[model samples]
Target: AGDIKAGRAKATQCAACHGIDGMSKLPEAPNLAGQTEEYLVKALNDFRTGERKNEMMTMMAKTLTDADVANLAAYYHSLGKQ
Candidate 1:
């Protein structure tokens, strides 16, 4: 498991859309608190590569490095659903 502290810092930007607890209040946004790491990584990659077509997600994913993805995935996985 990665450091939660580190993950929190990286997750700051994510909170705007995802919420602090990983639950998105928006209808279209999916709750990510308890998602699998593999799924999170795939989604991030999809956004980054344009395989998925959400403008905001694509822009957000572009800001993340591989380590950022791993750390965020670990953090979200730790939440175990909300």
Candidate 2:
């Protein structure tokens, strides 16, 4: 849960597009809330590594450490997909 809390704090930056809880306010941004941890982690990694190609995501993912990806995934996953 510590990671989740940390993630929530880091996620304030994300709240501009994905809500503080992981829901997205922008139509172009997918909801991060309730997504599976694996998916979130993979997506972040891909963006960071350039396997996925979204201009904004590429920039954002590069700013994340592995820990950030894990924590964010944990936090978003805990929010549940419903």
Measured by lDDT, the strongest candidate is 2
lDDT, candidate 1, 12-56, per-residue tens:
888877886888968788888988888988898889889998978
Provide the overall lDDT of each model, using Cα atoms, as 2-decimal numbers.
0.82, 0.87
Indicate the TM-score of model 2. 0.92
| Local accuracy of candidate 2 as per-residue lDDT tens digits, 5-28 | 888888887899999878789899
RMSD of each: 1.8, 2.0
Best by TM-score: 2
